[model samples]
Target: MSHLPAVTLNNGVAIPQVGFGVFQIPDAETQATVSTALEIGYRSIDTAAVYGNETGVGRAVAASGLLRDELFVTTKLWITDLGRTSARDALHASLDRLALDRVDLYLIHWPAPATDAYLEAWQGLEELYAEGLTRAIGVSNFLPEHLDRVVALGGTVPAVNQIELHPALRNRETAAAGAAHGVATEAWSPLAQGGALLAEAPVVAAARAHGVTPAQVVLRWHLQQGHIVIPKSATPSRIAANLDVFGFELTAAESAAIDALDRDGRIGPHPATFHG
Candidate 1:
């Protein structure tokens, strides 16, 4: 089995540096695909209430026969569930679908500044954390200002801040802001939704130099920069290939070259304006 490295979060909980994501993965295909990933050595599985595949993820994990402690599962609360009571109820609903007693990490899916209740939602996460329903809690797609609000509201500092990150859309500012508060940055669209950054000249050059795929090169860049990355793939070969990045290293020049590819090209919805 491949030994994936782990990064300790602010709360002293360790998370696998590389995780498997199931975004937009059809519900019907989720079980088999996630089971294949587990068979390929992916211990961390990320899903969300919005994904509509939490039950599939639950089924795969249960069927994997891996010890509950051996796997790290994460899920998120949706926008509609954005207050203390509703957030707690939403978490219970998600847990029912996941069929797990407790998720390793539960995150607030979005700040939804328009609703202006993320702080209240965050307090609900705090209650979950205190109640031991989740080991750790964090937020996703939160900008610096949102984090600042958390700081002002006085709650547990988020252990992770998941955001859309890739070479072409390096969110250094948000990552740095999270880092300032000891929140580990986790990349959601780590491969730029798979293939856009893989074709970039710098990424291609690094891949050739490393004798690996461009996707591997980009994942290595994220790891080298100390960010947690989850690259999603339903294809068996590509799933295995994505985790094969541990064998090589990216040089400083090569890393910088890929960094230079940043053009503020964000491929996902902007957190500032995305209400859903």
Candidate 2:
């Protein structure tokens, strides 16, 4: 089993640097997929209420035979449920589905600024954190302004800011903002969905030089930079391969080469404009 390194959050909670993500995996298939990931040594699992797979994640955890403390489970509150009372209820509903008393981490799925309710949601997350419903609280798909707003509220600083980050879309500004506020930056699409990015010159050169796949090379880039990355794949071979990134180290020139590939290529919704 690969013993992955962990990044300590500002709140003193430790999260595995590399984790398994079930973004688009259907609820019915989530159990077997997550089960495979667990069997292959992935201790961190990232899902969301909108994914409709918390039940499956719960089932996988229940059946994995691993101790409760042995795994790190993360789920998010959707935009539609963005208020103090609504967020609390949503978390309880999620807890029931996850079959656990408390989650390792809980994130606001999106800012949904137009709704003008994320602030209330953040406050609610603060309360949940205090109530021990979640060990830590954070946000996802949040931009610099959004992060600033949360910090300005003057409660608990968010422990993390999960974002759509990859070689093609480095998102340096938002990441810098999170860093400025002591929030850990977690990369969601760390591989850019495995299309043209894997075929890029720098990624390919790194792969050939290291005798590893392009995906592994890209994952190493994120890891070497200290970003928390979650790369998901339904294929068992790929799932196992993604966790095998801890074996190699990227040199300075190679890392910079991949860094230059950033062209503001964003594959997901823009955090600033996305209402959900």
The candidate maximizing lDDT is: 2
Task: Give the C-alpha miss distance for residue 184 in model 1, angstroms.
Answer: 0.4
lDDT of 1 by residue, 181-201 (tens): 999999998988646778999
- How well does candidate 1 match the true structure in TM-score terms? 0.98
Candidate 2 to truth, TM: 0.98
Predicted candidate 2 versus true structure: per-residue lDDT over 32-147, tens digit per residue: 99999999999999999999999999999999999988899999999999999999999999999999999999999999888669999999999999999999999999999999
> TM-score for every candidate vs. truth?
0.98, 0.98
